[model samples]
Target chain A: MAQASGKSAGKSFFGKFGVHIAVLIFVVIWTIPTLGILVSSLRDKDQIIASGWWNSFSSSTQTEAGRLPGPEAQVEKDGRFVIEGNIFGDGPARTISAFGVRSATPTQFQAGQAADLGDGVTLQLNPDGTFVLSSPVAIEGRGQRVYYASSAPPRFTTENYETVLFSEGIGRSFINSLTVTVPATIIPIMIAAFAAYALAWMRFPGRALIIATIIGLLVVPLQMTLIPLLQLYNGVALFFGVPSKTYLGIWLAHTGFGLPFAIYLLRSYMAGLPKELMESARIDGASDFEIFLKIVLPLSFPVLASFAIFQFLWVWNDLLVAIVFLGSGSDQLVLTGKLNALLGSRGGDWEILTTSAFVTIIVPLIVFFSLQRYFVRGLLAGSVKGG
Target chain B: MADLTLRQIKKAYGAINILHGIDLDIQSGEFVVFVGPSGCGKSTLLRTIAGLEEITSGELKIAGELVNDVPPSKRGIAMVFQSYALYPHMTVYDNMAFGMKIARENKAEIDRRVKQAADILQLTKYLDRLPKAMSGGQRQRVAIGRAIVRNPRVFLFDEPLSNLDAALRVATRIEIAKLKESMPNTTMIYVTHDQVEAMTLADRIVVLKDGRVEQVGTPMELYHHPGNLFVAQFIGSPAMNIVPATVEKTGASTTISITGGRKAEVPVATPADAAGAAISFGVRPEDLRIATGDSVLFEGRIDYIEQLGEVQLVYLDIGRPDTPLVVKLPGNSELKRDQLLKVDADPATLHIFNAKGRSFARDHAPALAA
Candidate 1:
């Protein structure tokens, strides 16, 4: 028995370590992309182009070309003709590692060393980018081309955020996304809550048919309905003399798309509430409205919050719905649309793309973290009895 | 307070009928308990009166007005649920005050009534606590307190004590009895499957089976003079013992012959046509005693003895194979198994049920009229 128990203990220890390792792997997998975006968004624009985001915390080296003074500006020093200049003109100082006169081999010579030109002529470049060339013959042509490798220390800046928010128009799109998301999340919740409560607790003719239709709608793909719905909205807008592409239009479209799932989630929760509560409320001199407001709504809060988070995230990240319903005007384009536009225009600019992506994800991350407690509670509500 | 009257009330769902026509008149200030086995429609009947479930066909009146179509809030009734059904999010104060607040009562009146109820239920110190934080009995009291603050004409309880543990059930039952005494004008209807609660707490008991009323009387009246075999077995613990017999003579005092060639006389008035009819002899376990003289009614061998501390139950096999007659005797009685014994019961305490399962009227003082 002791041997068996000892073996079992060893098995449990391994089991626990295996679980922890699995969790660590998942955490790394989930966080790597987010960390990449955050690191890339904060780096200097020049440094962003120099290396990968993971190397942002270390120095980056690059080979760059520059020019020297011509023969007229050469001065005679110690019976030799000399030309002197800085490789990097009017820019932040960088450490020069090596220098070369040929493009084929930019770092052929190390800094602080003289290299012969095969006619008693030599060139020397210092670590701080100062270069001197001495020749027996007067230099007649334009200064010989010079190349050098310089290493810059790790750099960080907030300029990318400023440029994306102001010059790239992501700030305005952020407001537009909020406008579409808040009302779209709230409107469907209001309508679906009433529908769910009635379906779960109230008695009326055709109630079962209505519930079945809602469930059937859940399986129908939103892609199938998009065109018909757009056309319908356009017809309504024309008849009413209103603009077809408006925030209100997109809000309604999102509400329509989210209602089926919202009602499905909420009705099951409302139905699971003890039947005695409603009856007791009725006997306590409460009308149907009173019972809903006083009892049903409060008890349904967890499920409501869970659905709110879901709907908010979906509408916030939605590109297709916003693009189809709203105009692509600067004032109306949502963050997802703006990001798509940026991908087309600034396709090669890593700083612009990564910073914009990070900005787009911030709101959803905040919302998920804040309401995660309610989300867990709501999912567990109907599976257990009592509290 | 107002009296409630129901005339031929019935409820059906789709094609399945739950309640056959039930007619009952509950006087004002009466504490009536509806007791039965599960699925007996007692809870359904209570809900129908509360107007939570619509009655399919009936005439229901509160005081003098027919309220078939009236909403529940306007019916002047309140209910305490088996699960307490207190608003879980609300504090005890808010739970009891919910009804008054919905009625738009003034602040002072609501506060006054809420405090009065809290004082009555001994919940003054816990008014700010939520239902989840309280014990089950405390939650039940909060439910009753919620109903009390409504000050309705009638109060309904749907198995309020069934959810409590045994010790708490007894304590809360006594609390409810005192609550009824303090508010003598409000008529209350309680429903439960427990016979002890029915026997102790009810002014009158309504025994139901298969969605129909079998008998309705005061606790003692139903105990001593059950209208049929169903009530005879339902109202007592260890239930009443019944044995098959054949009627030999029918008169003011009818005589029946048992299966073992034993004859017993029961003091019940039966018609002359009942002679030679098949019948059942009924006696309670606690009513029989060991016979010491020659007037014994039954002779059997002891099959088994169950030794309870205060009393012992002796099972006897006279002739029936499926059921053995049990007699309750003093504890520590020196009676071994398989020993022959004779038992007898007073003729006045005996019961005779005709072939139709209906009990014949007794010749003693009329307990039914009382």
Candidate 2:
């Protein structure tokens, strides 16, 4: 009876407007700005400039202008080179607020009327694609291309994505990010898994102190050591006559920065493995290396894979460390650093920024999804008594 | 194939000693079990014998060769761990062949020995499967098979069946017994806390307590005559009921007055020194029966009744709440709780122990208390 009441109480509490209220609040918070960004990214740049992305759903009353016919079309109805055309064509026209021949004086003339040009010449362009020009002087070469005030329906373009990927060099940056990420993720996992097994299981002097000290190092942020580490690398490179700025420098830097946390996490998991399994291996005549390679490695695969995902995503999206430690030269720049550069140079081009950002995040998504299967809960097999 | 001996074996960690001055010997081809409670160092002793642990201050020998400084692999012993510790990455065939492969033995010899061990353990059909794919019993068999292929002189099993379910434990236990029987020339040391396993499988049971050897005897010998009170209570289920008694007479058979104003003649020879002294009389639950005579050892009301499938335990409370005497009856017997009853036992089935928890032998008794 108590359980039944408790369950009902729990049900009513969750159903008593709390869940719906929370979800309603969350939906209101998340959906609005995402919808705004989507609409803004999709809308025509001209429409975006004229109004806000919020006004995109309805047909927009925009002012647009086109050129009028040249002096050749101006037959001598009144003994002048007459040019005539309507600016708006084949549809219902919105209000033509003003028009001008020069861009600086775009509002020089009002719609549905002729403007005086001070030589007894007049030009008139209607909402439709027809115009009348009476010129005493012969209109040769290019006649004034009349700009008319007109409205344009709201529109969007996929050309932003195309320009960013093909022209902005984000596509190559995406390839470079994958190249940096995959190896960075894999190298640390292999090295740390071996270290974790030794630290967790292999008994030697100062094991506990070493583990405690490594855990202590976990809080020391990578930013604090970046310059000193890079200085050390450059000093070494000077001795070997190798270039200071290379992918080798960046890869090694990321690896060194990622190793402590990886080893710590993997060691905690490996230590939690049942002691009986290790003893069993010893009894089976397995040397310490065999036990580590055979039992500990297979059992610890999930933690290894989880740490790999963490390190991969971290290294893939890391721009600060990459910029500080590695060269910004075009050949050695990673995707994140390159994407940051693109953002500064092409800030006005939303297409270039969004595509570049998305390209940089794609590899992390793929890596996280593929290796996540290894992070299971009960890979221990319950081998111990009562476990 | 080998006689095992421990010469004053002791284990200590820093100032705290665990096993103190243990000495024992086993003839060739004896199946010895180290049985004790938790923290009794039975498993530790087994590990020391297997050379997985270093003996602190003793000479360990197999057929009179000292192995104190030898590594586990060089000790010529194979161990089956309680968790079976099968290599999860390898197939059963490869797992069994791993040791010889590590030694760089020829492929043909490795194959022949691994196949032979597989045939013995009935794992031939599943040789290609991994440890995770096999059941618990199959995994245990594979662990045993890995040990068998080593062809060592002594076999060590550290609670190898403790991980299995009841049915599988029984099945695998029978298989181990048969393995010991067929390989009669090999010395085997098994460790367990289960009394039935120790009783059924051990040629000799070495009972332990707090890192000290309590008693060592055959299962029936330990059953019939335990060396001390601890072994007496530890080796049986529904443990033997102990009642405080006073020695009233000294003769060929010791006569003691138990609680409820009745006397018992336990079949322990008395000396002139044991007249009018205090001792404890022990009776197994199954040995007690409803008495019709005046000298019933315990006369009381049944405080509780527990019914098994074939037997019933009648808990007789003579006001010793901590250690109440119980009498075992057949399952179909007419017995119930809250019934006033008289329980008695045969004189030979009784055990007499003095105040220090040491058993008094049937042939000899201690001198009188001053």
The most accurate candidate by lDDT is: 1
Residue A195 accuracy (lDDT) in model 1: 89
Clash pairs of candidate 1?
A: none
Across A1-387, the per-residue lDDT of candidate 1 in tens digits comes to 999988988789888899999999999999999999999999998898899988988899999998887788899889999988887878999999998989999999999999887699999999998888999988889978889999999898889999999989999999999999999999999999998999999999999999999999999998898899889988999999998888888888899999999998889899999888888788777777888888999999989999999999999999999989999998999999999999999999999999999999999999999999888876776676542
Where is model 2 more than 4 Å wrong at Cα?
Answer: A1-63, A73-183, A237-242, A373-387, B88-94, B105-119, B124-134, B249-252, B292-298, B317-322, B332-340, B363-370
Most accurate candidate by DockQ: 1
What DockQ does each candidate score versus the true complex, computed on alpha carbons? 0.69, 0.38
- What does candidate 1's lDDT look like per residue over B20-72, in tens digits? 98899899999999999999999999999989889999899998789988898
lDDT of 2 by residue, A57-89 (tens): 766665455665565666666566676655554
Residue A251 alpha-carbon offset, candidate 2, angstroms: 2.9
Error of 2 at A337 (Å): 3.0
